[model samples]
Target chain A: MAVVSGSAEQTVAHTPSTPATPGAPGQTIAIEVVNLVKRYPKATTNAVDGVSFSVPQGEIFGLLGPNGAGKTTTIGILTTFVRQTSGEARIMGIDVAADPMSAKQRIAVVPQQSNLDRSLKVREVLTFHAAYHGIPRAERNARADALLDELGLGDRKRDRINRYSGGMAQRLMIARALMHSPDVLFLDEPTNNLDPQSRLFLWERIQGLNARGLTILLTTHDMIEADQLCQRIAIMDHGKILALDTPAGLKTLIPGGVSLELRVRHAREQPADGASPLLAALRALHGVSKVDETGSDEQDTSGEVTFYRLFAPDAGALIGPATQAVLAQGAELRDLHLARPSLEDVFIYLTGRNLR
Target chain B: MATTTSPTASNLADVAQSTPPTLSLIGGAPRPKHSRLGLILIAFLAIFRRDLAVTAREFIAFLIQVLVQPLFLLFIFGKVLPEIGAAQAGFGAILLPGVVALTVVLTAMQGVTLPLVLDLGFGREIDDRLLAPLPVALVAVEKVLFAAIRGLVAGAVIFPLAWWILGSDYTVRTDRIGMLIGIMVLTALAGAALGLTIGVLIKPEQIGLMFSLIMTPLLFTGCTYYPWASLGSIKWFQILTLFNPLTYGSEGLRYAMTPPQHATVYGHTVTFAISTLATQWIYLGLGGTVVAFFILGVWLFSRRVVS
Candidate 1:
């Protein structure tokens, strides 16, 4: 292997070519999925059912779901790794099913798992990937080196992939995917197994790449990751997209913006016997939308230590009524807090359960 | 809705798209069955280095498995076969080439199959190769080639050991050396071809069961010891051996090494060569075809399984 000038840890300043602007709306469709359906022959239910969406050029689109929700399945169809039983997926106006090679040429895929050859140095991984894109040998090394520097893998370029930490291996995978300089990239849970710092660093690199005019389509079970990175996200469940919008837009699907969290303080009291009176009065509060039990009921607890996550439209006003109601009931207040509606709320609203 | 595109984005897309326009410089379609000679050499060297890296990590096991198994087989045939009065016209000499051929074939086959099973089951290394834009068939081809080289090395290592153990009593004709090489290549290829088929067909979890059920049975029935023609009275056994590609491989190897007078069946001299070649070609061709099918199966299966 030819050694390059820079050390693996050398920080290469990456301006990223002015971070390409988002593609113009109504210009042309980069990807279009129409009523996609996929069913494994012996499987009881369709893995992907009647899913449809479109990605305009130069956008960071996210498909968000918990495990078994078919987010990866949908990406597989778009990437041409799997054929859809029924539906149409077109990349750059080219139908994937009709002409996979042409569609494949327009995109790159970074799978969830690290698949680098353990025997190969990190740089060879990128170069070999470039070779599959039919990139000329003379140019591959230069481009691969640049990508390594850009992805912050410059220092580890010569090390065998097996020597890489999980984060390092993931960055190398991203670098290999970008070696061809593809128009669009498909990242399937690209940060699945990274540490928090590594995840944040990878997210920054991903953002930089997206800003450089690469249309990125990613899937993840992480609501936080999706909210932080994706400009638009689709919340999918049971093979169907329940809602598609910006993260803030999805959050708005719930009735209230504020959530009032409560703790019942009696160590050996039954909220059920006395909670009914308190619940009715709390429900009658002016700004309260709904009060729902979150954890164990006061009666079931060894001591009366029930916790409830409440939904309220106005925490400013609702807190006053809630406090007064508890005082009137003569129940000791353990803790009471208020916060904005979270992605978990949106998930509960759509799927009737928490994400995990 | 037209919402996201910017001038810079179009400019970047234009640049990325322009690179592929020069693809016509390399002719498209009907790519060569084997990688170019340069790539073949590189692939051979690279795969060997990779195997050695893996072997180095488990040096003790490799020494026993790759080196000792063949040595033990040679010991039994050379020292024990003659001592037990089981000699049939220089059986030790005859056993030497057969064991060498078997070592080569089995090594290559194991080299190809074991990694493949690991990839398919737990490791998933092969899936990375599948994702590469290279034709799926090339992956299978690379594996067979790797096996062929490994097999040759194993055969070379055993050749001298066989000579030392058998001594001067090892009387074998050197006139058929050219044919011996031919038989070696054929046997190696046939074994690799069969390995490829099995590698794809069996899942990783089933690998152990398959070794016992399929590979072990095939090896035992392959006429590894006595020639197929020598089983004349056992009509059922002879007919059964004909279906086995390895039987043809072993017989062909013996025919190439042994002189005409020492040949067990005179009538089979011409017929054996033609049948061996025919069976070997058929198995090799079928093996290649099956490999293709498996690639398709794996691609589809992964998609379906994941979804």
Candidate 2:
């Protein structure tokens, strides 16, 4: 077998390789958790309750949730930063509680905040991290230089860490984590407050690293990031995994996969509250899973206009009949829209709360 | 890291051609994880080395930090006072050890505590050290050891400076070299341990309170300005001094480096002599303080880092 390498080809995004999909079945598991529970000291409730999931080798998995939803707590247990009240977490098959040293040897974490030591020069950060992993001196120097170059931190090698901007420090932190070439990388809120340009670069870097077959598990409160980068996502809330699936798969969990929005005005110019007749007519259409009078807005009209979203198996099947329903009620179809149910909608549907 | 068009990018082609292993940037390295003990040693030393590098880079600032106060204290007390007839003869002999002890103790304590508080309180910069592959406790131990080294080095610098400044007027005893070494090392370690304990126990904002309430009293009551036994008349005051670790530090060094005879007025003899605490009591005090502080430091460090 050809050993996966962080070669030049991986650095240049290859259209041929799809963003990492869930690994094939029977693939070796890189990280595994079975009914993990963590109750912090003096806490009345468990921080992580019966959480269970596994990431296959080389797959990028995400734990997506709002703050205080136990994402960090679960990661703490997996990374051996905190002990679980009960249950098991294993990295590369080594039970973290039983063998954290071996587990830590195989993994690196790029935390949400930059924890780079401000005392040392930029290059020293990577070299010291590599040294901590027991890379031989000569090997560490080589690896540090290469990482600095790869992460585009070579020119800042001699500058003190405090001089670096937020994004630069973050990138340096990533380089430091990758210095030892760890088998598994954990990214906590990887792009939480990053500028758009820096966020895109980080995305590219994450993809490039994954392209080299590095297994990654990241926790993010960002729904878009979770959708774009993770092969699989676990939506968490109140210390539990409320839902877990591929982004597309989770959207299907909502009864209707598509959302159809319509702006309606009655021919008589009456305030366009949901006219009972129009609601009844649309509810009768095939593929119409659900309907609700969402809101009303006064825009360039003396009377209010009704905004209704109809959920259906397919927007194409419902739009024709839905428009007909508005016309049948002698209402004008002022505007129409179609959108796929997003992960955010899936989260709101499952938890009855918005992430932010 | 956000330097998209950094100068290195232009030379990437040339450097890649010159460096063979540049292509193996992320993965190709043969990671030779050491045995358990070996792993801990390597990680511990890497942390120590990083501190060393930073210390080296800030050599001037560190020198000022460790030297200025001690230099002034030694000069005024050992040379100026005696030469101007403001202090008695054997006063230099009595004062040199106390000054040296104070310098070493303060240096070690400041060395670890200041940075530790900053890193743990707000910066979280210590995370890299905490997450090193070795057991997290070793990393804290490594910090204590490095601080102890700084204390020892500060003591070393003071001795030479003392000689140059005071000339023959201040001759610190070198006869009991082994006892002196033991006292200095133990005192240094104790200072470092106490520093680490304070670092974890206090918050960033409370650092001012710590210096004013904790450090200031620690300095004066340490017996650096006067012999512990001299406070015999103020019995309650003498008893209170025992609570400060620096009290043990100064008295222990005085016991090691100063002579036993009474200090005569207006005599600047090279032979070290002073009336101070019992030799056995000093050793026991220094040793006990080290043990207590180390245990507290280790416990608090483990608690902070692991959480």
Best by lDDT: 2
lDDT at A40, model 2: 84
Q: Write the per-residue lDDT of candidate 1 for residues B75-102, one digit (tens) a residue.
A: 7867777778876436765566567667
Candidate topping TM-score: 2
Candidate 2: segments with Cα more than 4 A from true spot: A1-21, A260-310, A316-337, B1-29, B83-85, B259-273
**lDDT by residue for model 2 (B94-181), tens:** 7878788888888898888988898888788988877788887777788888999899989878888887888876666678888888
lDDT of each: 0.66, 0.79
- Interface RMSD of every predicted model, in angstroms: 10.8, 8.3
Give the interface-residue alpha carbon RMSD of model 1.
10.8
DockQ of 2: 0.30
Please state the error at residue B40 of candidate 1 in Å: 15
Could you tell me the TM-score of chain B in model 2? 0.86
* Cα lDDT tens digits for candidate 1, A1-356: 00111111112133121122233323345567889999977989989999988766556788988888999889888887777999998877778778665565567788888766665567877766656555556677877777777677887777877778989988888877776666678999989889999998887667656545566799998878888777777889999999887676777788766688778654345545565666677777886778775455545344556565667655666777788887787766788887766677888899998777
